[model samples]
Target: MSDILFTRTDERLGEFAVRPVRPAEDTALLHGWLTHPKSAFWLMQEATPEQVEREFREIAAAPSRAAFIGLHRGRPAFLVERYDPAEDLAQVHRSEPGDVGMHFLVAPTDTPLHGFTRAVIGTVMELLFADPWVRRVVVEPDVRNRAVHVLNEAVGFRALRTVSLPGKDALLSTCTRAQFAAAAGHAPEGSAAERGANR
Candidate 1:
């Protein structure tokens, strides 16, 4: 079976695609992305390849959670995680029927494109909402990470409050499909927002 799980296009960014993460096949790539200096917020900068693989393997084995590798124009460009909020975030954010917790990390690059990160996040949101059962997307990003906060708001996420997670203080936020569509539509194409980083 082909591994691709979702595909979407950005008017200016060509094609963006996603596939189930293969721990063995993607270890090297994920390790590099997770350890890059830019990925400081990912909290695994010192993680070994084995540690990274083990993490993905755990995600792969979880029925309530799944991880995917995101592609830009068919090349891997980011990482995505989707989980049922009821099972994963109930302690922090009360469970809701259609809530899905999300996290994404863009691969660090020597050449960062203007507006590229925003497009990546926007596409990720689109991918999640395409599932009719998913009513909203939730995130708990480090409160100190201002860059991601700007990017999150740029795409329509409303900050609910800060909460204590296992390792850090996270800003709990959410965005609905209507909110995303409104934000995406109000913009003048791709140039109207700030970029994003990982959780």
Candidate 2:
């Protein structure tokens, strides 16, 4: 088992844990998740085990990109990533000193549960703030993803602008630790220095 990043145990829902990705062991399941119709934004129609391994290996090799697997009751249930926004979007958005880019994919569950996706999104935001130098979490989700738009707002990210990427126009959004704390109804975790005193 890997180190746990975040977890919660509620009588109704059982335990949920978030940790780094192990694509070698999880390639098949992840492939299914990424190719599902609901995951169209993923843009990978079909991927072999070798392809998945290579991609994840490259992610692990790049210091600027990091991926994690989220577990619900000790089972892999979601995938999320964080990268230097400047690096990920350098071809488009000009690099900025403190921008961190992030994305998430929630696995399709056989048993649907209300608010599960929201909790997963909350955990991702919390993880981003875990770093001391992350001044802002930047996201460029497709403007058409209205469901995720609501989720982003629930976590205190406000729309900054609409920007066009290589293939799709996205709604750029950002959230700082203070904004997140207010939305989540809890003080930011870890050191306040991590949040920095910046707009």
Candidate 3:
């Protein structure tokens, strides 16, 4: 059975689920997504299937990282990765106790849905913040990827500054739990309990 981590519903997109990645089983599918022209910023355009399998295997074995496959209804639609900033991105930025780093990529479709990408990002943020200990989420996307910058803003990520990574200049950004709540239109975390008391 697929080890499902969580499930969420988007009003416009219906239901989607996230599950632990099965490296061996998911390699071909992931390879296709990462090599597509639209995935240029992912920096794996030339990776072979064997290479993809090896990479994911290492990720799965890492204690500070996790990879998830996003499923729309029942079909795979996207990928998500969560890592401990202290271990994964320490070279690029300072690590904090409650900080978690994230990366996601939506599968390319010939016909794209108007709000699909936004919904995907929102779901990813929601998943991260669902962990009570996660106070903030961090991302370092390629600076030249304008579409993602816009999406990041819409989801409440504030750009800090650009930093040169090994191969790409990345726009470092962060979103706090409260920021995500505001952007996602939910009341801030203690408000609901306060409201219940008032009632």
Model 1: colliding residue pairs? none
lDDT of 1 by residue, 18-133 (tens): 77788999999999999999998889999999999999998878878888888898899999988887877778888788788899999999898788999889878877776667
Which candidate number has the best TM-score? 3
Model 1 segments more than 4 A misplaced: 186-199
Residue-level lDDT tens digits of model 2 in 1-199: 3366666553456666666666688788878888788888877767676787778777877877878887888888889888887767766666566678898999986787888888778767766777767778888999999999999999899998899886689998988878989998986553222221110
Give the Å shift of residue 164 in candidate 3: 0.9
Shift of residue 154 alpha carbon in model 2, Å = 1.3
Evaluation by lDDT, superior candidate among 1 and 2: 1
Candidate 3: lDDT over CA atoms? 0.84
Q: What's the residue-level lDDT of 152 in candidate 3? A: 96
Regions of model 2 farther than 4 Å from truth: 8-14, 94-96, 190-199
Q: Tell me the TM-score of each prediction against the true structure.
A: 0.91, 0.86, 0.92
lDDT by residue for model 3 over 1-199, one digit each (tens)? 4366777878889887777788999999999999999999999999999999998998888877888888888789999988887776778789888899999999999988889999889878877776777899999999999999999998889999999887799999999988888887893322111110000
